[model samples]
Each structure stands twice: as C-alpha cells, then as structure tokens.
Target: MKKILLITILSLLFFSCENLDDGIKNSNSPNQFSQNFGQSVQRDFMGQVVDENNNPIESAIVKIGSNHVNTDSNGVFILYNVNVFEKFAYVSVEKMGYLLGSRSLVPTNGINKIKIMLIEKAPITTVNSGQTSEVNLPNGSKINFDGAFEDENGNSYSGSVSVFAYHLETSNSNISELMPGMLFAEAQDGSAKVLQTFGMLNVELAGASGEKLQIAEGHTAEISMKIDNTQLATASSTIPLWHFDEENGYWKEEGEATRQGDYYIGNVSHFSWWNVDAYQSMTTLNVTVVDGENNPIPNLGVTLTDQSGFISSTLTTNQNGNVSGLIPTNNSLTLEISGAFNYQEQIGSFNSNSSITIVISSASVNTFNFSGNVLDCDNNDFSNGYAVIAINNYVDYAPLVNGTFTSSYATYQDTFNYSVYGVNFGNNEFSTIVTGQADINVSNTVSINDLVVCLNSNTINLAGDFNLVVTRDDGNIYTFPNEIIQLVSPNNYKTTTTGSWAAGTIAQDQGYNFSINNLNGIIVPNQGLCQGYYSNNIYGENYNGTSSNGLIINNNEFYIQYTITFNTGPRIYTCHYIRN
Candidate 1:
C-alpha cells in the first residue's frame, strides 16, 4: 500500500505558490538515525523507528523478508526467528503521515538495531482537475500538470485534485541517511548501477475525497528541479531520470531531463520518487571497522558521501565488521562512521576495488565486547539456545555455537549496563529463559560466561484486536476501537508471516507493540502502552500500574492498563480488549 505515494525524503523542501526557503547546517554530532546494534545471531532482527527530528516514532510498520511488526510506544520492534538471505535484508517502514522509508543492509544476528527516520508528508495543495495547475517550491522547483486527472479506477476525476509534493536538497551532508536507499538504480536495460544524483522529486495526487489519483492516460506532467548553484558549473546539459519503485524499493531509469538554466526539466508519464542522476563508474569498496585492539565492530554506521553530491548513503557494518558497497571510482569521497562527520578521508583508489580499515577511538582505556555460554535446567550444555543481550540501549542477540557465543568486539559506551537472557530452542518452545545483568565500567572486552538457565516458564498468545482508551490528566478521554495485535510463539517467535499489527492510538497513530512473559506478565522493557505526549508518542503514558497476563479479563477478554505521570498530574489508560 505504501507504494502508492512517492516518499520525498531528505532535506525538506515543501511546495507552495510562494517562496519558503530554509537553510541547513551539518553537525559532527548525530545528524539523523544512529544504530547501536552489537554482534548478533542471524535469526532475529529488531530496531527503533524515529522521525526526521530523531525522536522515537511509535506505530510505524517495519517489514523484512516475510515478517513485519509495529513499533511499541518506545519505537522499538522485534522480529524473532525470521529468514534472512546472503547477509543482507530489505527493511521498510510505513506510517500514515510520513513517507515510506526503506533500506538494504547487511543484517546482524539477533537485535539488529537501526533507527529509520520517516519524512513527514507535507500539506496538500489543491487544484482543479480540469484546469492546468502547478505547485512551485521555495527554491523554484515545480511540477506542472496539464489538467485531466484520473481516479484509481481509471475514471477521469473532474473536481478538485490534491497534490502532495516534496523536493530533496542534495547539498545537505546528511543526505546519506535522508534519501531512500543507497545511490543505486536499475538502468533502462535492467542492469543495476550506482547513482550520482543531481536532484530528486516525489509527486503524488489524490482526488477530492483523498482516494488515489494520477495524471490521465496518455497525458504527462513536467517536473522542474532547481539545480544547486554549487553544481551548476559541473552539471550536465542532459541527464537520464530514474523513478523509485516504491513497492519493490528499486529505482528504474524511466525518462530524460534536460538542464534548462538552473533547473532540470523533464516530462514523466507516471509518478514515483523521480531522480535526475547519472550512473557512476563504481568499484567495490570494503570498509572494516575495528577498535584499538584490532577486533571487528559489527553493526556500526558507515556513510559514504561523494564530495560532488553524486553518491551518498549510510550503511552498517556486518558481523565481520565490514561494509562492502560499490563506490564511485572516479570521484573523491568522504567516509564517516557512526555519525562522526568530522573525520573525512579518501577511502580507496580509482578503477580497482579497494579495502580500507578504520579504528573507532574513544576517551577510554580498553576494548568493549560481549561473549558467553549457556546451560540447561539440569546443568547440561544447551547447544540449541539463543541469548538476548542488552548493553545500555545497544540491545541484540548472541547466538550460541555449541553452547558458546562471542560478540563483535569494539569500542562502546563507557558505562556498560547489561541484561541477558538465554531462551531455550531445544524443543521449539521457550518455556523459560536464563536471565542476568550487572553494571560495570567497561574498560575492556567484557565476557559473560557460564550462564545457568532453564525453561522455567511459558507465554500465552496475546494476539488479537481490542479497543484502546487513554484519558489525560484534565479528564479528556480518547478511545481507539479495534486495535490489532499479534504475537508469534517459540522457542522461535515467528509471529506474523504476512499480516501487520496496526493499532489506533491518539498517542501512537501508527500503533503499539509488546511481547508478554507468562511467568509474571512482565512485558518487554518499555514495550507496553507507552507513547509520547504527541500523537502516539510511546512514552506519553507509561504503565505505572501492575502487569497482567492480558488474559483472564472477565474470562471472555484480556486487557492492559497503564498510568502516565505528567507535570500537572496523572492519567490512566485502560486498553480493554474485548473478545469475540
């Protein structure tokens, strides 16, 4: 369904008849999203979703392989025991008010943490379907449509048409994380090629009632994107345009755009995330991230920016502490790790493939790593087990190999507050998990070993639909009826194969997520009905109350109640799920 809209992500440029310009600056600190995932087992994947502002966004749907999950109030979602292929996975996010966001990454084992920043949709511009109309951006970019629009059913739309348009500034340093996938595209001949973008635009249309609409058959719309002044001297007179296939997450070469003065003007037969980009001559660039000890760092954020604004995107290091992608062979580029924009250097040589190694430095003393082993209820070695490891906010899985496992060792946060649990996979049922934790000043590689565990408990299926209600301190009540929920079972937690859990919340417009432990109804940490004060802010109303199995609700239903404390007072949210 998200393929229907063009996700105009990046440095925001809202369209208007009048100029509304905004300037952007780059920071050495975190720009957009950051990933803290450690060395992980390859079976499960999890992460958080955030908006362009970097705050956690709840209810965003995350799809990977054939599994999907909704972000909890904390913007955290997990997929257990899912399938992955050849070290890479495709991840996509969908929220109502934001454009679709997706990426391709070499996934870590369990607890593959990534923060995806969804670009909020700009306000719609209304135009008559029967008359020519154009929406101009602040920077002089515009999309001109020559009347005659059609609804989704192929019927001509005669009334008002709503246009949603956005332009992405390629000059921004953070463009690596802001754009849709890496600078890669499918050529007119179906071969994949790396892209060096000149400019990008996403155009979308809806009818009077918000149903999908498009330019009439055999008609076309002209897209004019303003070229950055800094690039005009080097910009080509003519460029091939590419359109992103939102459904497949691939950009395809579609049409051509001619550079006119300061803009690239093109006529497009259809709408998608269109880009004026040229195929770059690329060679494989392998980046290895390590610590002072020369150990590999897994899941570290790596960004490659073509100084000329031709190629840019962020990628994460894999389990071997390596990130391998095609980079422009002829252009100079900058490579930064984990949001450190200050460190810039030429990565590799031209023409031939190259490998570069970099170290993650800190103000600390030694390396930081995770390693451990597991035991069963009778103190027997448990080979078929997986461990959930959390060091501060860096949560991930450490899969056991013959009852032992090791993390990708590297520099990490100074204070290592940890929590670990070993889940039994011996019988495909997680009756219990061995749990442990401790706070330590992480000066060097920390290994957790000889962990005693057992299948001491079980979990119930809390998957279904229900009504979620939240009441503010001043007595304002909001009710969301029929919120959907799903929970996959284990030893392997393969919850939903194709379906997505969508809950309606005044706080979480996207929805909420949670996994219950039948042992004590202790839901995953901060995974309950927490939302932000804003629409679906997961931390808005944290459950200060006790836990429930979310079952045994009058025998015919189940429920979850939470109390949130505000500066003014307190409010209670009773998410009462009525059974059929």
Candidate 2:
C-alpha cells in the first residue's frame, strides 16, 4: 500500500459538525447514451447509502479513486465521469458513527449505479486485557479474547479494549448491498480467485483514546458464526478464512475455519473484514443493456441472483451501455433489471466465457434525444472530452468527439431544468456550466464551452470491446467474440497514481484477470494517447494466457491491437487484440 489510510476521530468530529448537503447530491435521471472509444470513453457511478432498516444514511463520505463525494440528504451521490480501471470499480464509504463500508463492481461504459448499507459502529462492551472475556452477538455469533492485547506498535498496551463486532448472515436478502466487495479473493499464492460465502464477520478494536488496536503478537481471537441453513446444506467441513483489504478491495486468504455442528469456528491474529468462504470456479459474462427497440440503455439496474438465492449488488451500464463481470461456472444465475417494467431472465447453467443481453422495455417512459458540441475555452471543437447536462440532481454525460456530441435520455421530469458541464481529458481542464430550461422530446442544441484542452502529454481512459485473436503453435485459433477491457487513466493534475488494469476473468482458466503494474502512457508521434504499460512479464492473462512482456499498443484506422507473446511451460501462443 503506497498510502497510509486512516479513519480519524477528527474526521468524525468534523463531519458531525458539518452540513449534510454541502457536497454532491443525486436524483434519478435518464441515462445519456453516447459511444466513446479509446481515450474518449467515460464511466459514471450513482448510488445510495442506507442502514440495515433500509433508511437512508446521508452525508457519508463516498470515494472511488481520487474522486470523493458526500452523500446528499436522500443518501444519494452521483459521480459523473469518474476514474475507474480494469473491469471492476471499488467504492468506499465512511460516516461519523458507522463501520467503514465498501462495494466493488464491474463498471460499464457509461452509468454504473449501486447501493451500500453501513452497519453502526458502537462498542457493545469493553474487555480488560488482563482478563479473558467472551461475548455473543444477538444472532448467535460469538467472539472470545484471551486476555491479551497490544497497540499497533506491538507494545503491551491496555486497560480497556472497546470491541466493535457484527455477524453477516449469508441468507439476508440485502446481504449483497452490505458485503464489502465481490467474492473475489487474493489467495496466498497471489492468484486471482472467486468465493462463495458461508458467513462473515466484521471485527474492529479501539484503544482507550479511540486509536486502533490489534491482537497481541502471541495471541489469537476465536470467532464462531452460525452458518445459514441453506448454505449449511452445501457447506464443507472446512473453509478458508479470508480478510478484506479495504485499500485494494480483494479478500486475502489467511487462516481456515472448521465446522462444528451449525457453527464455523475460526481464529484470527489480526482484525479486519474476515470471512468464511470457499473458492469457486468463475467465468466472465459480458452483459449488454438495451431497450425493447435494441437501443443501448445506460444507468439501468441489473441484479444477479445465484442458485442459492444469494443476491448480488446491482450494477449499472456505462456510456457504451454494457456490463461485464465474473460469474460462477456451471452455476445457475438469474439477472433482474427494473424500470417502468421488470425484466427477469435466468442465464441457465453457464460453463464458459459468454455474453448476455437484457432487453428492458421503456415504451411508456418519456425518452428524449439531445445533441451538442463540447468546445475548448475558445469555443473550438474539443476532442477527448465529455459534455454533461444536469437537471435537478440528475446528470447526463455525453462523449464529446472532435467537438461534437449527441445523447438520449429517459426522464419523467415535466420541464427540463438543466445545466451543462464539460471536461477535456487531453489536459486537466473544466468548462463553465450552461444552464437553462427546455421541453421534453424536443430537439435542443447545447454548447459547453470555455475549457482548456491543453497541448499536453498524459494517459487516457480505455473502454469498449477489444477483438481478441489467438493462434497456438498447433495452428489452432481461439477467437473471443469480443474482449472487453477497462483502464482508468490518471488525471495529470489531480493524482500521482499511475493507471493499471483491474482484474477480470474469461472462459478458459479459473480466473484470468492480472494485476499489471504501472500503466504509463506510450504516446505515438502524430497519434493520440490510446494505450500503455510500463513493466514486462506480468503474470496471469492479459487477453487469454500469460504475457512474458508488457503490452505495446498498435493504433491504425482500422483497429488498435496489442500483440502479446508469452508461454505456458512448453506451449507458446501469440495473441492479437483489436477494438471489436
């Protein structure tokens, strides 16, 4: 971890005293549709924070990458044109008196909406380090401390250790909205893996002065959770214990838990979001979101329901209007998308990499199309940018290509009271917003001007499908109908973090996504910044198999491809990827 992350008492106090509506707010608005390839692709996310009782939790600090926004009074926050990499996006939220919460999703090209539920962080009781104590949660989960405690510095500490604990039931319908991240786990071997949860626990300790504490060097804490009856039917005698890495958003396998009767008992030497989950074989699913007429839809909510009834957090479509993520192989799953109408379909037992299209009808909703141009501060065509039209608290983000942009929106607003904003990724610059009122289903021309598209060198966001063609030594060719990839760029002036590909999986192997390090821009002379990588011999699969060297982008009028050559023991394969 390059940065030190902390949840400070000072921040809690500051938030408790600050106004709730001081920052970002959101309202449900129709998604704006636009096709943006390579550098011009944009990703947006909107979601709400709530409590166990389904009440909105407002003013929470929500963050994705360097962009952070406070939830509005309605517990809604929308981040337009956010920075997200790989196939997944990690979002963390914090409030004054709640357990830190986070949700991870595979963001689509345009609008990705999700929901998060935060548990309250109140110490049930204080235990003295000099005496052993055991506490049981209301849900039959139990925790035991053996009279040993230490500060984070490893020194013997200790008067009273305040313990904050919660048991996460796998059977809860809303568990998807409350879980930290997807079932992905970072195994001890550093391989990418997925998980099926038996149960989970959130444990945290605070010193006498509210500072963080941990278990003593030679001590361990025991946790026992009652496995849900449904999960118990298929639960094994032993399960691997994993802890959440909040900073990286992947579960880290550590210890193991043994089943005893109806409970799973585990011991941990440290505290974090610990879980009892077993690795599951997974394949990738490329989801296309569209209306009944086949018009690509954006910001539509799609929820996954597993065979065991374990529902997944809802994900939204991006500007390119699609969703992509991992799904358990040979497992029955159902996708449910809600609008004026509810569309539910079961993707029968899926065993390999594939794609699914969900057609949601919006025939009764008011749909409108708007066209405009995104210009520089001097009112010239601004390429590599996005135009925004916000009404009430809802926003529409349209890609600006060579200064021109077009979008379609579905809104129920009586009259359009909208505002426009733009950004040029070529450089870290923003435009002055244009505000006005318009009629529904009426043609409107919008010009979002006065922004600097500076002549600078930097990385750019990558989205859409990359056509993959692989030819093995045996002359056997494997073709992936489409290879969807995401690379969130580093906004030159705002962040120092270099961009990298987020993990994802495909058909062949267990899980195919790799953690390719340091994605720096490779600027081709006379050509725009399209793709990049700074290291070689990365592990796992970039397209199909492992790459012995880092990727180099080849851009042309027809298609942009990355020719990767690598090996697996005695087998060598050459893979060429073009924008599909």
Candidate 3:
C-alpha cells in the first residue's frame, strides 16, 4: 500500500509540471503578426489626365504596383500603399477616352511619391478619310493657297491638294467663269487630310475697282466653286448697284450670301448716310476799345467801313467789352467811336480778319485862365517896371499860353494875365508859374486852387522869388536881395548831403508861401522870405541868359505843393521841392 501511494503522488507531481509547462508555452504564442515591420509603409502617386484638346479627363485609373486610385475632378489621382518589396514598380494610368500611360517607379522603405501624365486618345469624330466640301470666298479679298487644315479630332493630314474659284462678270446674268486654280500641301500628315477639301477658297478679284468684285447697276450673279470632288454654289440676289433718288431719300440694297444662308442683308437709303463738304471763310475782326484810364469801355458802338463803303452793320460790346464784326470779304476796314463826356473823337482802321485796339482820350474843352496880381512879402501890391510871370516847372503848358503877365511900374501895382490853352492835364504835367520884375525887387505868390477838379477838387500852392534893382540918389544902380521872398512848405524840403541843394545850404534868397483860397486866383504870402540860395546855383539868371538889371533869383530852388483828386474816388496831396 505504501509503494502504491508513493507512485500515485509522483505521477500527480509529473502531471502538474506538464500542465505548467503547457500554460507557459501557450502564453508565449503571438496574437497577431505584423506583415510590414514597425514602419507605416505607404505608396503615393499623382498624375494629370488630359485630352488631345488639353481638356482634363476625369475618373482616370492610376495604378502603382498593386495599389490603384481614380482621378479627381481636376484630373488628378493619388495611389497609396505601394508594396516596398518592389525595387522597380510598374505604374500605369488609363481612362475610357484616354490612351494608356505607364511609368517605372522605384520603391523605398518610406513613402514613394511619383507623377504620371496621361494623354487622351484622339476622338473618333476626327476625319479618318480624305474628304471635304468647298467654301465660298468674300467679294473683295485675295486668298492664300498654302494654308493649314485641322479637324475637331486633332487628326492631321498632309498632301498636295487643289481648289477652284469662280467669279461673275456681270450681275445681270447668272453665268460665272472659273478663275485660276490654287494648290497647297498640308503641313501635317494624318487623317486630317480630309479636312483640306472643306478649307477656305482663296480668290482674287481685280478690275476697275482694284481687287474688288463689282456687279452691274441692276442684275444678279451666280458663283460656283469646287474642291477635289466637292462642289459649292451661290447666287447674289437682285440688287441696285447705284443709288436712286426717292421722295424721302436715296435707296439701295447690300447683302452677303453663304452656304448656310444670307447674312448682313438690308436696304440702305440716304437718310442712313451722310455727305460732307468742308470749306473755310473769313469770320470777323476783333477790336478792343479802351478809355483814357485804360479801362475797357462797355456798350460802345463800333462802325465798320471798307474801301467801297460803310458796312451797314454795327457791333456792340460784349460782357468783356469787346466788339467783333463778321465781314464777307477780306479788305481794309475803318472803325469809329463817338466821343463821350468831354472826350475827343477816336478813329481806327484794320484789315479784315485783323484785330484793332483804339484808345480814346478826353478832349480839352477850354484853355486855363490864370489872372492874378503880383504881391510883396507884406501882402502889399508890387510896383515894378514890368513884373514878368514865367512858369519854369510846367514846360508842357508853355506852348499853350500866349504872352505871360508882367507888372507895370508906373501903376505902383502889377496885374498879371495869363492863359494856358489846350492843356491836357496829367499827361504832360501840372501847372507852375514864376513872377519877377526889373529894378524893384518883386516877389510874387501864385496859388493854383484847381490842381485836379472832377468829382473832388484839390488845391495847390506855389511861390516864386525875384530880386529888384533900385537907383540911388547918386544915379547909381544898386542890386540887393528881394525883400519879398517865396516861402516853401516845410514838408516839401528834402535834406540830403549829396543833392543839388544840400542840407543847411541856402536854397534861395527870397521865399514866399502861397495857398489856394475860394477857387479864385489870388496871390498872398503865407510865410516870410527864405534867406538861402541853391547849393549848385541852378537856374540862375546868368545861366538862363536873362536881363540882370533886376534882382536875380534861382527858380529851381522853389518848392511846389499840389493835390490830386481821382475821379473814381481818392484824394491825395503831394508836396515836393525843385532842386537846382
């Protein structure tokens, strides 16, 4: 029994050990096996599929090794999971309408990217046989024989071919004559040779109208041509070659015919057309008129007269105050404008189509009348043999005046009368006068009240100096400085170191100041006599070749005060001195 029990225990132990070994082996067995190592091996491919016309082909099949993909909407495809075991893989792409395309690709351990381009097969619609129909040519163009022909399928055919052209000599009849034949060879070789028969028919029609086909005034013409075995014929419908006058306008018809149908057909009339006649003519002569103030004159009437006579037309000024008149012929013309507001008559002339500008100035109405008596420094009347009143500053007024005024010595008082005529004020100068006498030293004071009188009046004052000679009891002549001297306004005196009359120098021996009063010609001394002479001794009696029996005074050293009044509206007073 003991031996049996030991055997049973050993058997049990052995079985237990066997079971443990089996469990261990079972646990070690692989659950799933990896076909490709640890790397995620994938194959990538892209390609474009296009037709003969360069149009994208969709749904194209792309294969790389055992992998395959379809083209996308843009004719592009991608293939993945290409077997890495293939050192050189065969890649092929195909579509229903495209030719088969293939490429060789080398597989790597990683991703393999490749590009495949597929071209579509030419369409069956392409001409496979050499056959075509003829085409008509335009009326006025010349055709070139050597040209290319292509079909819709992109098939090309090249060979020598011939074409015929027909021209109708007259529209009145339907008869036509065959022109010289044109021959050409296709640039490419293929089934496209059939398209050559339907190509353009080049015809050159030349006659009176160079290279243009013409029909009679009233007729129709039939044109027929042939290419290889094809024939094409057309007839021009009846049309009027010349325009006819109608009540409304001129009428005619123009149209074009083709194998499909007639096109660009319509009836044309003069109302839809226009005739141009161009010409040139002399229009007018532009003229500008200005007043004395150089301002444009508005509404001024301008008369035009030619050598023959006055053109009965008159032109008025525009907004810019310019006048222009149109004349038929180019000739010399005269223009005139009436005077206004004390203005003188103005006349001007110019040739036709020429421009003229006229300036009109105001005329002088009357001569200036200056009547006054010579007075002394004490406001006493000057008694002299002859008191001569001379104007030194106003040289322009000298021509307008008669003999100047002179004081009479027998009267013991001098009454001066002076008239300045036809004096145009402001153009030349303002008026100034100097008075002197022999023997008795007489200083005169002259006042010009109307320096400028229009809307506003200005007053001017002027003074003159003179020396007197007296006979003493011993009958000897004695010369002395005049007691009555002209006094100038302080504002008119200018002090300069280098001037003719320097500062502190004696401007004149006698000085008297005068002013305008009551618009009357009256002489009175406003200031006492000045006791200075000119530094340069200017305008002395010796230089002027004057009789020195009386007191000699420098006229250029006197001072003159004047005022100016503008018509439009400003009033100004100016004071200035005359230097020797």
> Which ranges of candidate 3 are over 4 A from the true structure?
1-42, 51-55, 109-111, 123-580
User: Order of candidates by lDDT, top first?
Assistant: 2, 1, 3
Lowest lDDT block of 10, candidate 1:
11-20
What TM-score number comes out for model 1? 0.61
Write down the RMSD of all candidates, one decimal each. Answer: 11.8, 24.6, 54.1
Query: Please, what are the lDDT tens digits per residue for candidate 2 over residues 129-160?
Result: 88889988888888999988888788988798
Number of the predicted model whose lDDT against the real structure is largest:
2
lDDT of 3: 0.28
User: Candidate 1: deviation at residue 524, Å?
Assistant: 18
Superposed model 1: Cα runs more than 4 Å off: 1-100, 104-123, 136-141, 171-182, 189-191, 226-237, 259-263, 290-293, 299-311, 330-348, 359-365, 372-406, 412-415, 420-580
Which portions of model 2 miss their true places by more than 4 Å? Answer: 1-94, 103-117, 171-177, 306-311, 318-321, 360-580
Worst 10 residues of 3 by lDDT: 1-10
Task: Report the C-alpha lDDT of model 3 over 301-354, residue by residue, as the tens digit.
Answer: 455555543232233343234654344244554555532322223333433345
Pairs with backbone N, CA or C atoms under 3 Å apart (clashes), candidate 2: 86-502, 109-318, 109-319, 110-318, 110-319, 111-318, 377-450, 377-451
RMSD of 3: 54.1
Deviation (Å) of 455 in candidate 1: 10
lDDT for each residue of candidate 1 in 392-491, tens digit (9 for 90 to 100):
4455545567778666433334454556656553332232443443323523555666666654544333443345554444566665554444422222
